[model samples]
Target: MSDKEQKSAYGLGRAARLNLSLEMLNEMANTGRPMDAVLSSYFRHLQDALERRDRRDLENRVRSVLLHYRRLLWWLKKIKLEPTMRAMLLADMILSENADIPQLEKLCNGARNRMDMLRKEEIAALKRLLGKEINHPDMSDAVQSECPDWAQAGLKKAFGETFTEELAALATKSTSDYRVNTLHTTPEEAQQSLASQGFKTEPCPMSPIGLRQSDAGGPILSETDAFRQGWIEVQDEGSQLVALFAGAKKGMQVVDFCAGAGGKTLAIAAQMQNSGHLVACDVHSKRLSRAKVRLKRAGIVNTQRVLLENTYDKWVKKSRGKFDRVLIDAPCSGTGTWRRNPDSKWSKDETDLSELVALQADIIKSANRLVKSGGRMIYATCSLLPEENEEQIENFLKENDKFTLVKAKTVWEENFETPYPCANEDYLRLSPHTNGCDGFFACVLEKK
Candidate 1:
């Protein structure tokens, strides 16, 4: 067939093609079905249709489609619709089950009404815009090949007009960022060291130790001598800032409670100059094992890992009021890392948040008893939600009279750069969009 004839046979515009791909991805995510089969089926239909597109554009298009699916899933989760309902809708659409159309329409209407009732005005407005586009007869027929009537309706209900643009942006590649391992080398020295391995580094805008990769196609961890020598650690710049706020020093005893995989624990050890006794404690044995391997690779000799399976044990009693510093890097919903781990945005829910808050409160209360008189304890989370960050700390302080807020500005200035405007209350907040780093919240308190 001629090129013009092939293009006509496909009957797909860029927007329509993107919509079809997203519809397929939405089906995969909702049903927990394998994506390869769906993608295969799509390509099979397009076998002679997609003429000689560049490999890069093809990859970018696929990534964009997947990101759009993720964004739609995130919206659905935020509004508290049942995951199964979403899955069923996707299945009905992909399988072309016309009988399921009424059910899909009913769900979409119900979701819209719920949004209106809940005062989600922005989403409601978006819905109205999407409704017009999806309901157009010509577009409706084009979309029907991939999306069931209900699936098309759900897309309008889920994303509105901003959906396509948002997903495309999310699909774009993010840079590989690393925080300098301050214990072994300075940022300048680390940069020089990494250069020997043909890995170029540039300073991150917000973090003193953070470096962004300039080149691609290198196995950074294995190829770099600095990485093997522990001169650099793979950590978000925002996380490094949280560890600096902890203010741990040589010759002081410190505890990192809930130190999962030891990202911040390694930072604390570096700040302590590998001299102070730093105990890395967690409930998970596997995470502790990973931390141990990392600590050894980093040549940190003063740190110890402990598994606190029983918070009420006598070992806990002996540790009470003994440490100079404590860091509760509490478990959280991880909403701030969407740029890096987009999958987490779909996996979490309101019930998960509630459960995490309860666990955080319990852990904090247990750790609080171990802080010595006049010693500092910092509570930190990679969460943007106020309920997990400020509210959790406020509630903890309210219930525990012995501790009071220390000036976060004073501590941060003493250890690191002041990133935000000075506030009366002693707390630090960093958002990915605002701070050019992962979202984080940290508040330091001293026991009276």
Candidate 2:
């Protein structure tokens, strides 16, 4: 082939390949496919193409493809178009190579800037979608400021930015952390176990059993016997605090309401020294089944799992005011987890948030009835929105006059020595950037 003809053919092929990637990314994003799934599929295709010798500069080509598509996704998210429509538009735009790249970049920047102005109504809607409130102040503010004109206008009209400005300063990243299940082993033992399997570990500054990964890209979970034996269950340090705040001791009766997969439930069981009754309840049987397997692996014998299917009322009545402590790890928007699930920010909308808020309110009220008089009912979420966290607590206090916010500082100081940027007041709020943990908020409410 002539040199000129070969060069022209290569250029055309490159353009076609780039267009294909953009189409796939748009489809996955709009269809609400999990980001992990999308990335996995993209990587697999890249590997196959490389094996077939269909592409040169394989790594660079893959990187460029991802960067181009990510930019496109960011633009689509900004325009406030429905996912299906957004995907269609993205497909069309990619086909038109004459697309204005500069214009798209501008729109992405504008959306980011307006996220902090997220309206009150928009905030409420977000709460309903996640079945919880937003807790990270900074994240909430960013949403308000960077939300597109459509969302911002709607939010302003419905709920003027009555959000706490203090929270905006408190938003941070979520950390990749795991707590050592002290029920079966100590931190030192867990560390030794992990190290033996070639997994490097470092102590988390904010949490006692928490450890951070020093290296990336290894089968840490599959290779370690400690994980297999349940000496350590992968959990956020912030989540560990939920059990710590419960103050579960030997012989105490504790109920882990909404104990999906028994992460915190197992933590509480360990805290009770396996000497007390800990009932872990969830509406979903599949999650409870998984929890059972985990419990077996941990050798935890003092805990039992209950399925409350189609009978939340009956279940509540059956065990009313029967536990020394009750934990309501309520459903939430998960705004604080944006670092890990950045796509959630785009997938979420006002309608979803509204539904979540109502659910959270109902769950809290129902769970509160299970706590014995003077017993604590701790509420927690991984979200950073105030509507899900602080506001929900505020509303709960107004409706139920018997519960009072416990001083979080007291419990935090007694258990750990790390100083948080946000004061330990009525609630314990941790951010990833500031506290080096997952964005989490916990409020210990004592029945007065």
Candidate 3:
């Protein structure tokens, strides 16, 4: 092909990016890679291979494709066609209005038969799939809700049927929200700094230091001076609440067990005014390494980073009954984070749930031992399912009579300046529909 034709055929647009992201989704499904890791790895490789800056719109378009993955698969099932044609016609259907059909020719490196099938499969199947409604009701509960059947049942049983509609929006459509690190600057100062740089931002209603910006049109958030200078960190409001309810005080010894990436650990440190000892422990060394960067960026110093060699580490054993408070951010199905990780909706299953629940039980029991008598421990997860949230805490209280439940409502009334979308009266539960944040569950337990 001529040089001009080559550029025209191979240029990656919205549809092409969606096709590429579908590859990421496939890897996440097949390889069990976290959606965040898979997407970041693919985009990084794409940018390196093409020797071009990433188009901001590309990630958004790809996310939209993944968000509608259930509907896309439903159509593929209906078409009676091979599932192997995902990158060509299947991705285009989701991006139909803006799909670049001609680009598929070069995406395939000038393969003729595949292109013909993509167009000619136009036979009867395309017609059937084309007219499907925006919220197609032809699907069962699982597909319509874009979740696993067990998750759908659990959420519905706990929250009600109307809650299922909110499940439809697996991810937030607005620009990401951030929490201002008061340890560095005030919320207004952080807002002003970002606004001065042409980033449109608004205060999050619930969090005193929460700032939100629309990704529709804005520079990359991580690139902002506010982030680099430790004025802000990308955190959800629900998360801020979880940390707030942890009730860390100055001069107190605290342990943030299972502190992945240190989002809440930083919050706890800031709340403690960097006064006392705070140990951030996690089993994953890589995640703690990432947390080390965030800690430095946030100008945090009070916290000690501990890499737990295992669930029962020597460090944990020495630290047991030493801390005034402990926070267990246990692993779960991650259904609550669907607003940020839409692909997770498709990846998790019952087997994963069984394993995670068992892990959570073990970690919570082990972590609770670190809390001193009369001290508090926040048992938390991003799972919407009660099995991982209330049930775990309930069982813990049942098994260990020395520890008692602390009402989330009572604590919220004491600390929060704004009202929360309260899901459970006892535990702090936030959902996407009611709270406009990622789904989260938190219950504070006190050691007697």
Instruction: Give per-model TM-scores.
Output: 0.66, 0.69, 0.89
lDDT of 1 by residue, 25-87 (tens): 566667655544655665566566654342223334444333344333333344354444333
lDDT tens readout by residue for model 3, 144-235: 66676657777877677676676765545633788888888899999999988877788987888788885345566777898789888888
Colliding residue pairs in candidate 1: none
- Superposition-based RMSD of candidate 3 using all C-alpha atoms, in angstroms: 3.7
**TM-score (C-alpha) between model 1 and the true structure:** 0.66
Question: Which structure among the candidates has the greatest TM-score?
Answer: 3
Model 3 global lDDT (CA atoms, 0 to 1):
0.74
- Candidate 2's error at 343, in angstroms? 1.6
Worst 10 residues of 3 by lDDT: 108-117
RMSD of each: 12.6, 11.5, 3.7
Q: Please provide, for model 2 over 308-366, each residue's C-alpha lDDT reduced to its tens digit, 9 standing for 90 to 100.
A: 86425687887888888888888877755645555555566887888888899989988
Candidates sorted by TM-score, best first? 3, 2, 1
User: How many residue pairs of model 1 clash at the backbone?
Assistant: 0
Model 2: per-residue Cα lDDT at residue 316: 84
